[model samples]
Target: MRQKAIPALETLMSAARTIGNPYLERAKKAGRKIVGVLYDEVPEEIISAAGAVPVLLRGTGSDGTELADPYFRELTCGYTRHTFNEILNGKWDFLDGAVIYNSCDHMRRIYDNWVRRPVSPVYSFIYAPKKGGELARRFYAEQIRDFLHRTEERFCVTLNEERLGAAIRLHNEKRRLQRELYAMQKGRRIALTGTELLLVMMAGKSLPVEDYNALLRKLIASLKSCAETFEPGVRLLYMGAHADEPLFFETLESEGGQIVVDSTGFGEQSCELDVREDADPFEALVSYYFEETPAVPRKFGTAPARAGHLLRLVKDYAVDGVIVTRLTMCDLWAFEQYMLRPVLEKQGIPSLELETDYILQNRGQLATRIQAFVESIRSSRGS
Candidate 1:
């Protein structure tokens, strides 16, 4: 069936495509605090509970790293450099405060650079544990408590139990809706393209949960009624790096590859699980973020869990192969890709890992490689 015009999708794309978003501007004008989320694991619900919008900052539309070069240097990952460049260029001026956690070295550098010349009022940094255990979980809960205290103080809003619970429910609904969207793509004939899904996910990151949920409902309804079938393509699970742009997916899909599932920042990885509304909000959030949610490679002793998560996705979505794309100079994801090769191979799955920059500087070459990967996957499947 032919896809009908869904205005919600266009609205979402507009939100995803630019740092300047209408919903955010409206909220700012209405005196709503905008908290910039620099890392994936930082709980958005806490920001929402503090009566702020948790805007997941993206480094798209980067002209060059010229301005941020001196500040971050060439050693940092391109995602960090480009995003720091955007912050320097005043693109992120709308942020009242931003949460930066030490999820990786790049994030730690971002916090340091931001401190050199802080853009927003709150340049808060939180510590996330790299391992999991009873002690680790308890320690992480304390860290979350400190963050909540800071957020409440910064925003001058009391995040009482009621408000925190409400926020958890709101974000949980958003995750549920996103899962609904993904379920639409699990079939052989998909409704939305990978680029389209990324745009939608990006929209969720920017807008208020209430507004995002509404727009998402409209888009989902339209899709349920009439989502166009995708053409013959290789089903893929895209992993590694901090990929938030549609261009990366566009490059992958250009060669008969469809990214049906992804484990990248600002994508499904952040919203893979929901916090428990029944338990203490902070404890539930800590558990969800530290223990339940998909851990990035920086988290030690999590390779098996992370790999198992990917393997399940491959089976659930009927993925033909996995393409691990890491931004250049990202030591964490680089190691992650190397470690995942054996895991995927053990399951008889073919994989490819490409090192590209934040803006995909090596597009022409990357496209050639992606084409080859898709063709090889198809050949092996005898499709």
Candidate 2:
């Protein structure tokens, strides 16, 4: 009966695509300005306050990365290369403007290239402070103020605390609803397949939080009466980013593995985290920064801690095997993958490692590997 959930999961992905596409369409129809945020540094509040929608742009599928090879070296992360490819291909032509943050050297160079040859004419570079020292804090504050001034001058929208707070409240409400949905999954009140949850979480980057929350709430309510029995399957815990794609989970399920928990940003990143109204917004931002597991290339204090934390999660969740889906060109995850594999294996845990693009075009290969790995684990258990 696990196979029966595939259609329902596909329906979820279809709904997410519809929701994300309509926002782009509405912006085009109304001629309302829209800006692409390169990474997580573009504050959702800033975009909301500026009267422009913030679309989180990332690389997906092989098609999006065709041109990126010439722009970014093969050694660079595939995500960055694919992002440039998307721009070069005019896939992001609908954007009225874009904000690129200097989060890392590669991303900084991308920002430089973007400003020089923008797909959209109104691109701006925002330098994100790397150090959390007092100087860095002051620098970032001034940068935020300057960015707001430029945004107001260009977009003719003032950034006020009230508007910012409202945006925060909206995001907070969305988080609450997402938490409810996650609770349903945790409690087995509904059996949402892994890929379905990944699609839903990914939609958060493009869709309006309020609308997505409503859809998720409706979905939860619709599935509240689901009384499916959990089959005795190899419980798995996923620890990487590329597993955020539903097809990855579908492949694992097809191989007789069930993902019971995930350590992906999509699964746990923005959920249950709230920006307190009374606290300084910048401080709140800094606090949120501290709370997040560092993405690739910025792994100072986070990697070892995240490794330990994930190990604990694996034990607690009763996961039989760990699947690490390292994204192609993501050096940080590659390093973490190396560190994590031996540690999990040393503990007598079976693990599988797979590298993938954000989109799942090579499902046949992935399925074959997963099936082999699951069979190996099952046979070992029997022996």
Candidate 3:
């Protein structure tokens, strides 16, 4: 039964890699609209309540940004550039509408470009609060309310309390199942690699919430029943930057380092906690997004606390080393890495920094660096 489930999990990964997922295609056939989400922090529950499927518009590994050069500056992050290029090249023309959140300056610039050019028929820019407090929470709630109102008006649908409750329940199940799957990585011997886990998490958001939840339940059960342990080299926790592709993880592991956990949005930050089912759904969403989600921009000035969080994961996962990856020209991750270096060094944890774009143009250099890093850790262990 466990062997029978591998192909099913691979199907979801393929759907995620494909721009239009199976559920989204089926929904379009039935005349349901698709809402493209720019960032992870956006309340997808709101989009679902508006009778639309929320699909995260992430970077493509094989695409270039040459067409997007005229619109954005030379130093624009590659992920943003590639996504914009896809829009300009008519790759994402199927999206009926888009909901963009102010996750960072690059994302906001993408939103600005879309507003100036108008890719989707309808658009909504949501300003997520950067800090946690009463005022921030209330402000976030108002933003969500506005988003819900605009979506309903655009789609001509009424998202009543009952519909909203159902959406919450569906999304909450996705989160719960993801947490259970990730829990398999807790001890020294685990069932899945970090790359596999990252793809599963990414694909979970790509498909419909109910379908993702069902598929995840099956995968988790298969992993629990399987007895194989991936005994690679030293255990490492990948920190910093958002990676939509698994090439980086593959490269790191190729050099004898097994990534066990990650600090990126695709890992522990991918809504492990569930939204309250009893409370008002919108308010619960606001609390879960603003209060629970941890992004680099939100913890800008507090690096020790962030590094301390990574340290806790190190202890929890029994990590031998860490690799902090930053996308070229990403100021947020760059600055965060600068702050996290000394903290990790003080703790005596081995760490390495890697810089790359969305595409794998310099694989040889990255492999060389990773091999050396892993060898150094092994040498120190023998000492």
Best by TM-score: 1
Return the clash pairs for model 3, or none.
none
- lDDT tens readout by residue for model 1, 1-383: 12466799889988988887889889999999888887667888999988889887668788788998987656888888888899889898878888888888876887887876733555567888887789988877887888888898898888888998999999999999998988887888877888888889888887988999999999888888773668547888888777766777789888878888777767787677788989988778887888787767878898888888888888998988899978888888878888998998889998999998888667789899999999998898798
* Candidate 3 Cα outliers beyond 4 Å, as residue runs: 1-5, 299-304
Compose the digit string of candidate 2's lDDT tens values, residues 1-383.
44444443344466444323765676657766777775545566677666677766665433556676776666776567766776777767777777777766666656766777723544466776654566766776676667667777778877777777777677777778777766655543336655566677777666655556667677666566555536436767777754434456778778777776677755655564677768766456545543443333354445566667777766666767888877677666777788787788788889888888766778999899988888887898893
**How do these models rank on TM-score, best leading?**
1, 3, 2
- Tell me the lDDT of candidate 3: 0.78
Query: How badly does each model clash, as a count of residue pairs?
Result: 0, 1, 0
Q: Cα lDDT of all candidates, in order?
A: 0.83, 0.65, 0.78
Residue 233 in candidate 2, Cα distance off native in Å: 1.2
Per-residue CA lDDT of candidate 3, range 1-383, in tens? 12344765777677766676678788888888888886567888888887788887866644678788898888888888888888887777888888888888887887888878733554688988676678877888889888888988888988888888889888887877777776778776777777777777778667777677878877777677767667657898987777777677688788778888787775676765788899987777877777665545454444555766788889988889989988999988887778788888998999998899877778899999998999999999893
* TM-score of every model versus the real structure: 0.96, 0.84, 0.93
- Give the candidate number with the greatest lDDT: 1
lDDT of 3 at 30: 87
